[model samples]
Target: MTLELRCGDVVTGCEGVVSGNTEEEVLTAAAAHAAEAHDLTTIDPATERALVAAIHPV
Candidate 1:
């Protein structure tokens, strides 16, 4: 999967095999990586929201 960063760079990946294809799982995992590895606490709220929404798809 391709995920666009706040800086407009697209990162194509996932660290490990996706156990379950769920939106919350994907977002939480990605967000955790952003915080832990990149030291990015605050990301674009709009983008984040969009990503989460896309994953969840009400």
Candidate 2:
């Protein structure tokens, strides 16, 4: 089962999507991309919750 998450879905005015075999893998890559691309060093609890909630099976 693959999991997908789109940055555009969680963040406003952004267009990015990521997918992986597992949720943890997707979140790790998404976090790194968020830091490098969006300059988000740390994800707060609320944002993390939102990210997780935005994840979908693909």
- lDDT for each candidate structure: 0.49, 0.91
| Candidate 2 stretches greater than 4 Å from native | none
| lDDT, residue 5, model 2 | 93
Worst 10 residues of 1 by lDDT: 2-11
Taking the tens digit of each residue's C-alpha lDDT, what string does model 2 give over 1-58? 9999999998887888889988899899889989988999899999999999999998
The model with the greatest lDDT is 2
Q: Model 2 misses residue 16 by how many Å? A: 0.7
- Tens digits of per-residue lDDT for model 1, 1-58: 4332232232345333221256566666657666776676765887577555444222
